[model samples]
Target: MSRRGWVLFLAMSVIWGIPYLLIKVAVDEVSPETLVFLRCLIGAALLLPWTIARGQLRPVLRHWKALLLFTVLEMAGPWFLIAYAEQTLSSSLTGLLVAGVPFVAALAALLLGEEERLTPVRLLGMAIGVVGIGVLLGLDVDGAQLLPLLAIGLVLVGYATGPLVVTRALPDVPGTAASSIALFVTAVVYTPFALPQLDGTGQVSAPAWWSLAALGVLCTAIGLALFFALIREVGPQRALVITFVNPAVAVLLGVWLLGEPFTLGIALGLPLVLVGCVLATRRSPARTEPSELADVDSAVP
Candidate 1:
């Protein structure tokens, strides 16, 4: 990676990381379904012109089935799950949980026979990461909120699976077009549920609205654009390393901006999680085939 690539990579890490805090804030004012709906709607609206101008609408429409599957797994399911989970879980926690995505993708690849056999180190790393997550879960302020944490885990699974779907099913599709159409489909799917929550009873504060706009425009649209560029410049394996940076930013923002408390559990568990991520993502000569699915998982969210 060049200096420019490094710059974009770090920018994307921060851009992607900050959204969790924004979602935490926005969901305070709106329901998860409503936030997801508005986010997809706004993101799709912003990307619509570019998608149209690029003439991808026809191909995307032609492959509607694949597009629908991608949207469901990648956008609708994961987006709502994350939003709903963030209602109770801290954004930093959510970001930490998401750090497991690359490991999940590696497992997915092994299960799908797309990669070399998994090594003991990777297995150990996955185990440590899971234990770290357990520690984080044990630290939850609201113990009865276990189901939401599980929901977040499921979202991470779906997020991890999304890349496999892209590589195995939609490998030829343009990334931007596929992402834009997926957002549009997600917006359409969530609209009915989100609409009822939007009663004309009270107006949202300006800050909340601005948060939503930033979530859609900066986090979704611009974030996705920069991520794709990074993937193109560096291979997916290297590009996926950004996940390591994202959680640090998220934790910092959570503490600094949201004033979320940091605890001994976070201090202890975060290093384990980061170490696990490093172990799982370490490039090895045995697995020399640059992974398309790895790239997909890295860029999925």
Candidate 2:
């Protein structure tokens, strides 16, 4: 990677990482659905105009079925679940749990008929990743609620399924148009829900509003553009490596800024999961990275 690639890489690392903290702040006062709606709405408003001006937006509609599926799996489901789970789980712990995205994504690829060259190291890596999950749940903090953890489990599956839809099902759709459609359709779907609460006193906090703005403008909208740029600069495979760094940034922000604890579980599980991800995904001919957006968007919250 060149100097510019390093800049994009570092920028994306922080850009994708901080969403966990931002979501934590926004959801403190706002409902999860409203947060998702506002975030996606801002992203679509910023991105769609360019796609339309360039006449690339219309072609994406032809793949609307797959596009819709990708939206539901990637943004709709995972984003909401992350918001909801952040209500209970520490931003740091939530980010750590998401590090296991590769475990589910590997399965999604094989199940979706991607011919990945699965090897012994990959299987062992998957095993180590699972054990790391157990460790995170076991050692770090005991009193965390089970329901939120289960919600995150669903989020993992949804996030894992999204990339396959983008990589295989919607191959003809350009990245920007595909992402614009995803955001726009999602915003439209949640319009009935988010519209009613826009003026609610529940979401009037200054930090909450600023967090929402950053999530939309910096994380979701601008982050997508940079991600594609990173892909162009370094190539898609290398761009995806940012996934490994995002959790660390999430954990650091959660601890340093949010005053969340750095528990033993995080201390122990973080490396195990990351190493497992590297071993599981390295040289595999499949898109199993946690931040598997097919060069279209940031990894996650």
- Give each model's whole-structure lDDT: 0.79, 0.83
TM-score of 1: 0.93
lDDT of each residue in 189-229, candidate 2, tens digit only: 98898888887945378999899999999998899888877
Per-residue lDDT of model 1, residues 1-301, tens digit only: 7987898888888998888889888888888899999999988998877889999889868778877877877789988888888888888888888777878878887898765676788888888887887787777546677777788778778877777776666777777777888888889989899898889316777777888999999999888778878777776777777888888888889989999888766887788888888777665665554443334455344
Using lDDT as the measure, which candidate wins? Answer: 2
Model 1 clashing residue pairs (backbone)? none
User: Model 2 lDDT vs. the true structure?
Assistant: 0.83
